[model samples]
Target chain A: MSLFIVNILDGLVTGLLLFMLCSGLTLIFSMMGVLNFAHASFYMLGAYFGYQISTYVGFWPGLILAPIIVGFIGAAVERYGLRRVHKFGHVPELIFTFGLALLIEEVVQYFWGKSQMAFEAPGVLKFAAFSIAGNAFPAYKVFMIFIAMGVFLVLLYILTKTRIGMIIQAALSYPETVQNLGHNVPMIFMGVFGVGTAMAAIAGVIAGPVLGTFPGMAVLLGSIVFVTIVIGGLGSLWGALVASLLIGWLQTFAAAYNLRMADLLVAIGLTEPVDVAQSMLSDLWTLTLPQVGPILPYLLMIIVLVIRPNGLLGKRET
Target chain B: MNRFTKSLLGAAFAGAAMVGSFSIAHAEGTIKIAFIDPLSGPFASTGNQGLSHYKFAAEELVNSKGGVLDGQKFEIVAFDNKISAKESLIQLKVAIDQGIRFIAQGNSSGVANAITDAVKKHNRRNPDQQVIFLNYSAVDPALTNDKCNFWHFRFDANADIKMDALTDVMAANEDIKKVYLIGQDYSFGKAVAAAAVKFLKAKRPDVEIVGNELHPIGKVKDFTPYARKIIASGADAMITGNWGSDMVGLGKAVIEAGFDNPIYTYYAASDGITKTFGEAGEGKLKLVMEGQLNPPVSDRAAAYTAKFEKQYPDYDIGQPRIANVIEMLAKAINKAGTATDMAKVAYALEGMEHDSIWGTKVVMRASDHQAIQDVHILAHTAKDVTFDFDNSGYGLRAESTVKMASADSATTCKMKRP
Candidate 1:
């Protein structure tokens, strides 16, 4: 039971972390009507920048400054780069972001080299916050959970209770209508894009120490973040949150168990096991839960896509 | 156009052609060894360091010793394989087309396996055109076992040999009770885990293997959960064959989790890992390697390391066998009395024995073409160490040395000689 509780806590931490990235991506996708392929790359930039800043000014200063820097870079990208490409339609914008992602990775490699950087958590947060079932929960992980939750609540309040959030939502459904009221739709779009990337960067700053700051860090989380937002629904922030948490829990639960397909096969009335070398089902027979843990998210995504194409909280088909 | 001017132009063109051919001939006269490994991508740092060492060995060791085989100087020509087996084959073909006879690669055992098969097929099909493969670092045991080829020879001890030595130390340590085995989900990782289990069972039957897990190679973003799982299992020690970013990530995660249990690894020291590990790994992390830098073995080895460090400050000779590879290859060529006749050189290399810089006697076992030498288990120490690695201000101090058996004992290789 304690192990189960620990797994849940661990899952919540992972799920909340995913929500941080998915929320920003979903917000950007909803407002722009174009999926930002470079969203994870922005997160990577955040981690790298945070690492660099932390070296000089410590982690706290990096936590505040890295996201601000990333926000400016994102705004510049939207204003200077994406605005010009917008006339060509969504595909071009998507392609531009994709190219931007690759370029960012190359730039990172050029500057940092292709090795893992020593981006460590702050000394105070390095110890275990508590122990359950003989397993000490890292204080840094608990810190991640709290920070992600705090971001979620703050973001929820701003989006629902504030006037800027109302205008953003209004622009999402009817951009021209919002623009007719002299609300400066383009500036709002830039702001949303900037805010979205900044959120991802914030996640990066906190997550980099744990996930590792490397050139491939973006690629590792890129598709999974997309899957989270897609499974939650393309434009639904709630959907992104639900999907991210579900994946986090699912993967954690799977890894924590050691279930085997061979045992299942034997329980299903196969008294004799097939020869592993000669049988075609050898791989299936040898499959274990931990071995297939990473792919469980994709399996869930496939199920969701097949059964409900729009996602759980998604309004339209994605 | 004047007739005299036309004649003058023709003579100049003829003179240039003669000069080009003479230069080409002179270049071809020198022995060429193609260094094929990843020069780009994630593994570039390792491959580049390997290349630098090969270059240094060729220059400082072989060429500086008045060349090998009657003044036929050795040269290293580099080709980036991009750490892909397909790319390595393509580069191998390109190297062959350019009249290169010797190939040196030591990054991935998968790539090494591919090259060996391709070289074997190429030699069988085109007997007149053959290339000898000198493997310096890839340690998948199958290369010298089931996949052994006459065209291929490994200077580094295979995985089984290294694991045998590692488990010997593990068995002797009474403090170790429960152990966990973790590795990258690949051939090399699988080999390490299998060998660890087998040897530990035989050497120390009382040792409990609490957990054995394999994670996706190079894809895992975080290893904290894995470290937590290891901690939960109450393992006293962990053994891993993960290298590169995997090693770094796992080590950092383990350290952060405050898992004080020792980690025994195949590659937890070199590259940027030692520096990144810093004080976290001191006294806790241990590595099994062919050479030790801390005690410097001999005056000659110390002097060589100093010279190499002075020349290339960025690289440490991670694969110390690089020196052995060049020195032994030179000895073989000289003994065979020809640099061009690879068949005679291969014959000369078979069953050859020498005293290596590590101050150990190394034997190139004739049966499997695998080098047999004493392997050392080094402990990561911050102080009371002779030399530090990667400018980390921490070095691996030799804790135990295991004298290796002949290749025949460890290998199931039924080598078919040409």
Candidate 2:
């Protein structure tokens, strides 16, 4: 069905956007063994910065420059701020990131105030890509999918093909050995942290118009980022990709169809068919794919955590 | 020597006595009013706006003009609610512990329900200490319908009232044979959608119900699939109870799909969506608001906005709902002639007939404490800017069309004023 195809595409695009944030979080979690709660806050910063820069110099350049600025800030935080907190143990590192997340939101409010910023789509990407089953898929959505895929590929290439990539992987599994092997391990950690944050920033630039640049975006995206990383496995990039796509597709399909629970119950012989109007749970049980989209990723994460523990494709790190 | 010592002691005692008397004179007793809302978390934007409006009303405006009540100065005591129902229970206790009697604002219905229960329990235990809860927003119809409280006074129309009014507008346009109903999945959204369906079915029996979709709130980052559903449903028009990102994203997705069908939405449209779609949204979307920024605004509304713009250069004064509530509350206090007695204030508010910036007089129904006001319908228009290379500019112009709905017709509360 055309509806089926459209939902798949919608899911793919949504999944890819989730991947952008999850990928960065997974990389940082693998390398540092500390969950950076502020990762989504960095993404929010990207959106606000992109909005400000685009307002002055147009959206395209802001798209490019905002990530770099965010990258430097991430790197600086890892080097000076996070490094000091890291010595206090993993809990303190998490607490620092949490504090950073709260601070970033407050700072954003102080600057932009508590209101939604109207970030419009650029002229070039305004039109629909094409129509399927009487529905037009916008050019911006295609642009977003390509941008996310590009980021994923670039990250994959850097992690696998390059000498620095091998060094980073070695540092992640056996940091003590890697440091003993005479490589600048701390510098590498900081670089990876910066690179991860930059990816989230890139997502923010592209997503700002669609999501609306607001003070609450960071808090909204924060848990989802954690969910994606957890479901994928904290240190596994491939696991994250798999989980993101799965979640995206699952939610899209959920919101697209309207399947009432009463129908299911009657078919399964659990309950007799009665007037749906009489049931208090009828309205609640009318499960549509769209209604379940946002919570699907968390549900998947909890399921994965209970079952696999180490994630679908993740290797257990000491 | 004894006389000199006595005179020095007497001078010190007189100075101390003068300082004590001055402190007592300045105090005059402070009345603490709690401003309860989501001060932190995702809904903080709405919550913060509510807080700001209350502060401006209490401290900068009302209190500055010799306070709301004679012999008592109104003091606003606010706290970060975190926007949770369970958290509101704790916050209510904290507010009570701080000696706050009159609660001014509650943003969400879920949180308000918890606070109301807490207030009721406190009242039952100590019959003399009953707190008055004034709600500004939270448009769940059940608040006035099944869950009407004697202590709670809702200022805004419930979801049912607004939806009924919306249905009335659509009933006149016989050409609109089919409509797609979309709303955020919450109490407010469900109530609005239910009211729309009920009224539309009863009034327009010939009209077909095409698609009614309830999407998850805050989680819908991409609404392309939903737009596809609307298009496929072949609806004549769309009525949405979406606000914030859901509204913005859904509008953009719908616009991009070339879905030229009219969109009739419940929420205000001064931000996000109009800003996102720009000129593309012109003539396509019809947003209903309480007041308009365009000329023909009442002298009071114009002067208030002008003064507000001068005071806060960054803020958009087009959002007059919160400010209007503040003015109405102030007027209620003035009419009652006593700020300390909430029963008197409530009585004044019930029968209160006042003119607002909308250039129309609103009457507060004494039955349910709901305000009957005019809904300003506007169409988005493209601005002709020669400096722009493309059609990148848009402005919300007030359309010539006006539709009026009486406040009494929508309310289900069968209350007789005491």
Candidate 3:
């Protein structure tokens, strides 16, 4: 019973982190129809910026300030940089983002060098929240969960309640009609792009200490974030949330349990140990969900692309 | 031509001829030592350190006095393998094409494995242009065991050697009966953990193995849960083969969870780990390795360390293995009187005794080319806590005790001298 609770909590924490990156990515993709390959690079930039600022201003202010700076940078980039490249078609736009990722990483290296910079959690969040059956859950994790939940709620409210929300929803269905009704579609895209980057930056601030602040971090998270967006349905916010939660839970449960294929084989009365180490079966038996967590979203993406095409909760053809 | 004008033209021609000769000599000259390692990605820090140390040794120590091989200056041409095996092999081919004879470094085990065959083949093809590989860090036991080669010289002890030494230390402490094993799920990790188990069981049959866990490399964020499992296993000591970020991060997590049991690790804990563990790590961890960090070091070593710190403030000279390797390489080149001749340098290195920055005379065993040195088992003392080495006469409390393994009995590698 305690184990089950532990797994669920683990799933929730992991899920929230995935949602943070995926939510921004999906929103941007919906508005722009261009996958920002450099989305994770923005996250890495946030972490580096947060590390620098927090050194002077402390963690709380850095967390709040870093995202705003990253968002502004995102807006500027979309306005001047990505906007010019977008005219070259989707493939070129994709190439531009890829190049941007490489450039950001180089810039990061130029400033921060190759070593990992230490970014500690705030003093208040350093302690454990409580122990469950002799295992202590960290206070910082609880804080992270609360922060993620707050972001999700605020984003949901802004998207569903405001005039901007209606415009975005309308634009998603018929961009031509929305533009025809006197809305500047390009400005909307730039705004969505800014907000998306800000979300990624916020995720970076929270994750810096755990994932580490390094130049390679962008590359590590870049493909995984793409997988997250694809699995969530390219442009569906709700689908992203659901998919993130599902993946988070799946990985957590897999790691928590010590289930092996040998155990399964025994259960089914195939008691003879059939050269388990001789084949890929050993890799399967040893495969914990967390071990395969980075690939899970990609596998789901392939399945969705083949089966649903529009993605779960994604809008069907008009 | 007139006499005065003819003289001027002759001088100009002579100067031009001399300039041409100098450029040709330089282009044809440099005896290239090819350094291959991952120069990008997460593991790049290790590669950078290796490059810096090699550069330092080559410049300040080797070439400064009078150069090597009858005053022929040494040159190092580096290639970034990026920690990929396939890439390293390609890089090796490129290095070979560039007329590289002397090779060094196996920065990561996988890269080392990939380039080993190339090193062997090149040496066989061009006997006069022999390639000698000096392994700075890759401690995979299989490299010396099943994959042992004549051309390869491991500067550090193989994984099994270190693990065996660790096991010997554990055997004396009978109080450490129940052992929990955790390591990165890879070949090096597996070898170290397996060696630990094998040696411990053979030496002390009463010692029980409580639990064995393998964590995926580069994936684990939180190791607190892993720590909890170790505590639940009721183990007296926890053994691990994790290093670098994995080591530091996991060590911090374990320390935060207040794991009081003695942690026996196969590699040296970095200053990074000590910083993460903060005040908690003091006297709690025991890392068995080839050298010590604080004190009992000679005045010369102390001065060298002070100088090193002044030069490179960002990095720590506390890593004895790195310092020792640099010292040995320098001494070998000086003794051999040539950097290019593999036979002379290899001979000078084999059974060579020299003083290291750690303030100990380490003898390189001729048989296996392993350093026969004292494994200085240093304890983590708080930065604030000062031990009076000379004034108080209290000496250093080794937390547990330092166990020195004699280099004589460890190996019996039969080699034919060239």
Candidate 4:
């Protein structure tokens, strides 16, 4: 059915957006040991920056400038702030990033105020790319899908093929060897941190128009980003891609249907409660697939965590 | 008056100001309405917007006109509830502790319900210090129906009341064959959904109810999937009661996904939503509310909006009822002959009719303490519009109006007067 195809396309868009955030996150985790809890905050910064820039020039200038600005801020945070707190161990780094997230959110609210910004996509991408059974699929969503894929390909090429990328990879496992070879590992880490945050910022720029650009935008995607990376495997880029798309589809399919648990109970010969609304098990009986769609990713993450401690493609334990 | 003087004169000025306030209050007295709502967090914009409206109305209408009950100033003291029921109760206690007899809140119905119960209990336990809840925008019908309170008064039309107005507009449109219902998964959303179903069935029984869905509030980022479901359902039209980012997001998703039918909504034209709906909505998006801004129902309404905008450029008069609330509160205080006697003031507010500046007659229904007024189904488009929202060149134009006479329906509120 056209509905199924529409769901697929929608799921792909959602998956790609998730992958955009997850890719940066997993890359940073692989490069630097600290999982930046302020990752989503960086994304929010990107969206606000994009909106500000777009208002001045256009959406194009905003797309290019916002992510780069956010990148510089990220790099500076790694060098000046995160680096200082790194020696205190993972808990402190976690706490530091957590605090940084809260701080960034407040700073954003202070500057932009607590409301949705009118950040829109370019006029060219405003039209529908195609229509499915009377429903028009936005050109911007298709553009987002391509951007994520392009980022993946470019990141894949650089990480495996480039000299700087090779050195960065070398420093990841054997820092002393890489350092003896005249490569600055700490600077590389900072660069990777910056680059990772820039990727998140890029996602923000792209997703801002569609997902909405508000103070709570970061918080909305915050936990879900963690879920994506964790379910994919800690530091596996491919794993993140797989997990992100999987979640995108999971949520999409979940929301697309009206599958209820009560139906299964009825099919199994269980009698329906006379007063379902008044019963103690009302929530259980009335529970629908779409109602719990948002929680699906978390549920999947828990299952993955319990069953496969490493994740789908993770070589090491999470 | 010169800068950088803090030792003697500045201290004396501070002392004088404190004594001045004390003398002012002691002389003519002050009616303090504790504003307990989300003053912080994501949804703080809605609460802050309401607070701004109340303050501006109090200053411009009541205070500027020589105050109420012979120079008794209306002071709005804010207490952040964080939009939580528990926090609202705590804030209610704090407001009550401050000797504030009047409580004004209208953000979340859950919070309103909690405050209503707490105020009811507070009045029962301590009848001498009775508190009156001046609700401005919580639209759950239960607050005026099943859970109707003697101490509480709702200025905004409840969900069922608004639905009554909305269904009137929907029934007139012959093209609307199917309607898809979507809402945020909460008490208010549930109330709107239930009322919409009930009203539509009663008014137009032939209209097929297609997809009815409730997603977790503020959780879903992309409504494309939901949009797809709506489109696939073959629904010609859609109705939703979603607000805030949810309203903007849902509205944008459905509109962008090519659901070209009319999308009826509540609270879709405020807090940057109007700007987002610009160019995209084109004429599809419509909402049911107390007043239409673009057409400027009257010169007074237009002036009030202009002055309010000059004062707070970042905010909008989303809740037009705030004007009615402050003016009526001042009138009730004067009519009751005392600001401290909340019961007497409540009696005054009950059965009171006021010709609003927006060219509508608002009647505070005595049975349920619910304000019945002329409700407008306004379009968020530029057709026959002047005042644009968020300066987006797209504003509300009245599509239809449900007068106060027809807006009033049978109430199930059992009057339990103190």
Candidate closest to the true structure, highest lDDT: 4
lDDT of 2 by residue, A1-318 (tens): 887887888889888988999999999998888899999999999998898888888999999999999999999999999999888899899899999999999878766656577677798988878888778788898999999999999989999999999999999889999999999999999999999899899989988887678887888778877777777877899988998898778877776777666567667786743775667766655665566567767788778888889888888742
Flag clash pairs in model 3.
none
TM-score, per-candidate, Cα-based: 0.93, 0.80, 0.84, 0.93
Ranking by lDDT: 4, 1, 2, 3
All candidates in order of DockQ, best leading: 4, 2, 1, 3
Interface RMSD after interface superposition, each candidate: 12.7, 14.4, 13.7, 7.2
DockQ metric, candidate 4: 0.53
Error of 2 at A267 (Å): 3.4
Tens-digit per-residue lDDT, B1-418, candidate 3: 3222444666668778978865653335656777888777756766765666566556655567666556655666778988888988888888877777667775678777667667777777777777677776777766665676666677676676666777777888868889988888888777777887888888889999887667788666555456656655678888888877677666666655546777777543433444444444566676766655455356655565555555544445433466666557666777888766777877888788877666556777777666656665556564322332111112122343334354545444555455
lDDT string for model 1 (B217-248, tens) is 87776676687778778899999999888898
- The number of clashing residue pairs in each candidate reads 1, 5, 0, 0
Model 2 regions lying over 4 Å from their true place: A81-99, A169-182, A229-234, A277-285, A298-310, A316-318, B1-103, B110-135, B142-155, B270-280, B317-352, B380-404, B407-418
Model 2 alpha-carbon miss at residue B248, Å: 3.3
TM-score of chain A of each: 0.97, 0.94, 0.91, 0.98
Best by DockQ: 4
> For model 1, what is the C-alpha lDDT against the true structure?
0.87
Looking at model 1, give its docking quality level: acceptable
Tens-place lDDT digits, model 4, residues B1-418 = 2111222455567777877865553323677888988988878878898899888998999988899877878888888999999998998898888888999999888888898888888888998889899999888878988899898899998888888889988888899889999999987788788888998999899999997878899888888888888888899889999988998888899888998899999888877888877788877998889866768877888889999988886678888888998998888989999988878998999989898877888899898989888888988887777666766777888888988834457778897998
Task: Give the Cα lDDT of each candidate.
Answer: 0.87, 0.74, 0.71, 0.88
